[model samples]
Target chain A: MIPTIKNSKWLPLCDVPVLDPSSWRQVIVQNVREGDRIAALFGCTHNASVPVRLYALLARDGQGTLSVLCTDVEKDYPSLTPECPQAHWFEREIFEQWNIIPQGHQWLKPIRFHAPYASSTKTSPPIGEADFFQLLGNEIHEVAVGPVHAGVIEPGHFRFQCHGEDVYHLEISLGYQHRAIEHSLIGGPNKRTLPYMETLAGDTTVGHTTAYCQLVESLAGCTVSSPLLRLRAIALECERLANHIGDLGALAGDVGFLPTASFCGRIRGDFLNLTAELCGSRLGRGFIRPGGVAFELDTSAFHGICERLTSVSHDARSAIDLLWNTASVVARFENTGTLSQAAARDLGLVGLAARASGVKIDVRKDFPCGAYADEPFPVQWGEKGDVYSRAYLRWLEILQSIHFIIDKQERFVPNAVQTQIGNLQPSSLAVSLVEGWRGEICHVGLTDDQGKFAHYKIIDPSFHNWFGLAMAMRNQLISDFPLCNKSFNLSYCGHDL
Target chain B: MIKSLWTRLKQHHRTIAFPKQEPRLPEKFRGLPSIVQSRCPKHCSECVTSCPTDAITMKDKQPHWDLGRCLFCPECSRACPHGAVLFTDDYRMATRTRDNLVIGPKEYGLAQPLEDQRRKLFGKSFKLRVVSAGGCNGCEVETNVLETIVFDIGRFGIGVVASPRHADGLIITGPVTHNMKSALEKTYRAVPDPKVVIAVGACAISGGPYIDSPVANNGVGNLLSVDLYIPGCPPHPLTILDGLLRLLGRRYSTSRR
Candidate 1:
């Protein structure tokens, strides 16, 4: 049994003992092998003179606790990628950010094409200019797309090694959208911080904002009333419903299923409008804050919201049910871009991507906190990690979220929705995880002696699940790329940040 | 097939009858702010200090707002002791010239149509290539939403094309990060002559929350000639649609209450 902390709770920074390099590798490798997942792994340093302190947060889903471990490294450390394959991306990121060589990292490259923390900004290489793994064969040809895609989408370069129509490999090179979000959070959680969090992943305004607010509230040792917690949960779920519904519509569009696509395209807005009705912004921008949410639902407002929810739920059912009944749409989605359960677990995938592959790792159910603590929704999943499974899983989660929102709203109590968040405890660390529409959203906040942020790390679900997407592309049809990509629907800015 | 038809019937006529009929926006929707300078107490700078992006600044001891830099968040309105800054549901805040975006006490003109020649070139049909340089997808999503049944921007002869060569202009979002600067310039150059540039959202207009960050430039205005500016953290689909219509000199109702 490993010692751990509950979600959205803080502990003294000194309590996280620093281990030697070898032991650090061994412990992480051992725990992950025993079925634990790395919620977050990053390096933090106050200044150039100090060695980077590497922190690993391993989530134990079955136990509902997250284990924390730390190790100090000056310049170089042995790679964990060889032993724990899931640590591959984390290692690459660490090397890119800190310039601390992961001595044996098989594929070392810039994750975001930014200058090392210790290096001058001018020396950084241009974005999307990097070494991509190549397969040497007479028939193996490469196809490269983007940084500027055709549609109204974020930019990222994708290199595909294809043999005829079959994709042999996909090398996704992002960072065209990095705006230095995490780096901007150091030393303070000022007025700019909340807006930064709100737009961290724009579609996930409520999800990411909730995680940040929860982390801040935890550090400040503030407790939100149950009704306020429920309100935050409602906003978070509304964000989920909109995106999930929109993604389904997009998936349908990719398969040429217009009935579901067109209807859902409009239906998704209804959900967003519901959120706007509550928060004043379509994306739930001004609704969530540190101590509690910024707004509250009165009895009339609450009833109006419920009435709209009922109507939208009915509309969503009719729109989405078309996809399941249509044979052509069902056939196109089945077994396309299939990722096996073993591959999913090994890759440490989170959210619907992992759940679609039968991985039982919902932060709400596993590490229940805030609104979820009082009432937990059952974790929904799929056995086959195919495009169909992912699509179906979203529908299931949509139903669950609607029911959860209505159930919580019924029990809502009228109370003061917000409290003043005082100074955070000095020299403390807090971890907050929210099950965003996509998956687990991890926010780690570390406070200095002056109760200001020493470091703030945000691990959007896209960070852990991008590799899972790349792996799913293996041996897949090059033409089905759009459908496959839409299923995962990873955020480019979230990953780049 | 029957199921599909029934579902489509159930989802009837989702589009808003905008221009002819006003869209019913939520009461809480934060749009254009009306600044009453006379109401402000002497030497007061509450709105200026509360603004995260410094969108509000004291000019001659009077608070001046630059719409290009505003996120439309509640900070300024909440901070004003005298109810001087009140955000009304006026979604038509787009402006043609950069100078028009800076608001004082008087009502400024809304976005003017492109010069007679440019409007003639793109009046009936307009195609744009949207570049999400460093946007969080908020603006991009709303821009994409215009194509949906509710907005159906296609009805207005406005479309986001797949390539810059097929476009009459470019619609750019995000603060334009250093990494994306060259790509944006290349996209801008790819479009043929007599092209217009529309900067949507605070990020594209003035870097929004990311202003003054080392990685991000102020916005598209600094790098290129912008013809229209739609202001918001992520401008509402209605705001964006209204801007595009006004830019084309299309007649639309302006009665926003």
Candidate 2:
């Protein structure tokens, strides 16, 4: 049986019995084959004498259990990608960080083009300069887009091998926004740590910060108040509302649907304004700190939020309904840039994108925590896996999230906002998963003997879903690329971090 | 089509008449930070210690807060027992030079207009190309909002163009990372002569939270000559508009008290 641990359970790092490399491989492969998803796999080193310890947190969605298994490695280990395709990126990341090669991994490449954490003899290659998969043909032409683009968007390179209008294959090269966030996070739970989490992905500030705070609080053994927990869930859903609205608007804009496009843009701000009502910042920054929430929602503020939410929900529905009603928008959306459900599962896609492909896995529902445990919402999914499915899923989620917020608001109980966070449990590990706007945001914190963070691994949902976007573009028209991309709306900085 | 037209007609004109009127800001919305020299007790380093980004420092025996470096978290204000550090709802925090972003007890001037010749050349049609070096989409989205129906920055003829060649200036965001360094430099060089560089958000101004990371070069100021610095974690859209309009020497109305 795979050693399973409850979510947010902080246990001594040394107590996680380490197995030999081969048995470790057997256990991981077996668990993954048994319908488990690789939530996080990373390496941590405590002393110079011992080899780097590898921790694999296997998430069994159906069971609502996380299996934490680890092993020590000196140089190389057998790659699980052949059996478990989801292990591809995680293994590549492990190799990149610790130089522990995943033997027999077919396409071993730099996940984020950055220097290894520890001093290494291996030379670091410049980011975006790696060899790309090339397609050679008589009539095939290559199209290379930005690290810099025409729009007011983040930088990342895209290479498409095209035959006339149809794209044969597309490779996305990122890491232009690599800010060394994960490396900078080591030995820190300082004043800068919360700010770092808040900006890890600027748009998902509440999501990332909440996950970070959850990890920290769990490690520090702090029990958050019920009201604060409710407030956090509200803020997270608000973030989801804003981003979903913005994304739907962007999708509409991409399809040349002007009415919904312009309306959703302004309406997105309304949700952000509501968040600003909750805290000071529009993006819900400064609202969530380590111990608990930094702000309070009084009766007037709660009523104010309700008033705005009702109006905004009405407006958002009317605006989005136009997209479904319009023929032109539907024609462009449906059957365009479709990712097969099989491919989505293979790629280990999470959150909305995965759900759009009919893979029903939501962190909140599967592994319930805090407010999500008490105030449960049904998981929403779509079957088509096209751009339309993705867009429609977001629309459905926005409506559902609005209702969820209203329900939580009506049932909110008054309690203390914060509690004192004591010193962290030394040499312990804590894993936290928050269903961010994009998807599942996982943060793993491992403390040394001194109670300082030895390793803090932040896995943004974008990191998993970016590959799904690339796969969706296979055999798709080059013209539909932007629409498909906007549907995904993966975060470059989030992935880079 | 008729329903759409009717909906559009019924919708309120979303654009705020700023400069002519005061833009509505939330009560807790933080903007320009002000320091009270008299309020700070000697040897009390509470505000400095509370600051996450080291934006607050002691200079000339008075507390100096760098707007460019501040995340606008209000931790400094909350940490100060005597209320030495305070944030005002002043959205007009954009300035012409980087030095102007550093706030002390003495009053500092707002962003000045371009020279007479340059202002005449591009004031009515200031086209900008935004390059997000490593910005976490916060600043990028806010910048994008400027073009939306609500803020409608295009009303002043200050629009974001598709190409750097078409732009009269560049509005840069994010702490310029090493990977994006060359691209930023190339984009900067691609713009024509007499072109201005505006750094928006704390990251673009002073690297924000990732200030000391090995991969990041801090802010755009380190690589290029920045003409304007608009400060916020991600500055409010109105604040961004206020700064851009002020720099262009275009005012809708007199400043409100």
Candidate 3:
């Protein structure tokens, strides 16, 4: 049996098969060995009488199918990381959340410095106080940065074990941006829920909000109108265009290429303004709600929007093309932070980072949903798995997103923007996967008998790709850390949440 | 090099002449809100009930809007049958005091200039160090956008410094989570005496949506004396710029009145 459910479809919670821990391990390890990926691995400790139940959501990209399997454990379970490297972070998160230890795990530490949700009897370790791996050679030294960085950015701690100028390892400790979003989300779809989703990763407003709304719609069995779907897709692509352009500019600035850097900085604002034109906020807040979008794009405004897009598109291409043609920028970016395709696959990297590393996986192409199903675009990718590929892949994807948005808008139809979102179906689970600009954004919701969320697991792409960044830093110059870091552009708040 | 110069000319000088020339926001932009209680029917608590952040409170059947707590969402506006609650296109909602954030269908004081001594000290060449305690990066991004070519806040002699010791003030974002409390305090203490504190976004002012979260406090709340409070889910770059200019006593006609 396939044991799979279609994307965004609700299944009875009781329908999931609960296997023994060994069998669960066998199933996950077997599937992963056969090219499946772990989309969401979390535990729910709702029933106090029963043990903490671990749920594994496995994705088979080529088949466009997802399988769910669960197992009940009292405390420790044999670690899967020994056999399947992709489950490393998920297992650490599971241990942190449920106090269920994964014995024999290679590196066990708190991913986010919070007391275990299963029990709060023990005092949790402080945020940046973990034992980071260190080297004790004659010329080796360690450098620590942040929790309060120099730039106007989010907080997280980075420790580099270096020998002179070369970096041996980079370990990142986060939880500084932890706002307890998931903790506050229990029994929600409340007023706080939409705002939480909107600000989940601030920059990914439309992508994350669309995922949350999809989960709600699936559980409530509400269907979005065609025009609304097109509008949502446009907003999402606008978000991608803005962030990718901004990152490209930052990358250029890092490499001392001033012209493209300066142009991209302003051009990014132009794209954000386009989103602000669609709705009120530049970040696309208040634009997406449960049943549908908050604002509608009028027929009259379409021409002006398309015009603005064309102009911004022209500017973006001109600015980014300079980066490719510049020898200095290309030399700086070429081999600074290389991650092998085999390593990327082992770590289960997703989104642009995965694509840049030559891993042919994209939720939009593999597991199509919403407007993506009707108007699919070719997945843009690179083969080098280095800073150059990551930077270049963003430009490729930006071109695709701009084309996709313009195409969708040209074929735009007018329809009701919102419909009534009914109460969710009781005792069910729904999964939503969105191709956010950063990567795959997975939101899985399990509802109680009263139709309130019992457990809401949000997996931002950063959770999967942060390790990839750390791995990329291996054997690179420590000074190039900022360049590699910006290349990945992982979210601290998104991961800590 | 020729291509670089050509691209530069093609991009043109992208900076806008804001403050001197009135800023142009999109028509759909939601900014400062107003309440017309007279249009409201008796015993209607619809707006209050619809607010996600409890930014609206009904006392004696009158809706009091708290901009500090508001996410600027459309739920309250849509639920108001009387159109009592409406968001104006006015983005100059930053305030000088926390109490001024809560208003009941009346005009409130916008962010006032820093008292004479501090303004004189920072009026020219003001430097700030931004600390993101627990922000969602919305506030941080907009604050960073102020330095971009379009806004070009540096034109006013204000810039972000790498260290707090070199800063004249601190621009804070986030709801001040427990993990970041000590770091925020250390940064605050690092700045010299007579330093200013500007709290940006609804999150920094009133914890915005994360108010009362177990792990996060109500922003900088009473932790530090906040000199200015810029309000929004994430304030627009223009809104933040307006607040800073106002604090420096650099007044200009904000809107096309």
Model 2 misplaced stretches (Cα beyond 4 Å): A413-415, B36-39, B252-255
Model 2 per-residue lDDT tens digits across residues A306-370: 88899888777778777788888999999998998999988889999999999999989998887
Chain B TM-scores, listed for every candidate in order, come to 0.95, 0.94, 0.96
lDDT of 3: 0.90
Give model 2's DockQ, 2 decimals.
0.77
Q: Which candidate's DockQ is highest?
A: 3
Give candidate 1's error at residue B145 in angstroms.
0.6
Q: TM-scores of all models?
A: 0.98, 0.98, 0.99
Ranking of all candidate structures by their DockQ, best first: 3, 1, 2
Judged by lDDT against the true structure, how good is candidate 2?
A: 0.86
Candidate 3, residues A333-354, lDDT tens digits: the string is 9988999999999999999999
DockQ for every model comes to 0.86, 0.77, 0.87
- Tens-digit lDDT track for model 3 on B53-119? 8998877777788889999988888898888778888888888999888877556778778889998
Better of 1 and 2 by DockQ: 1
Proportion of native contacts present in model 3: 0.85
* Superior by DockQ: candidate 1 or candidate 3: 3
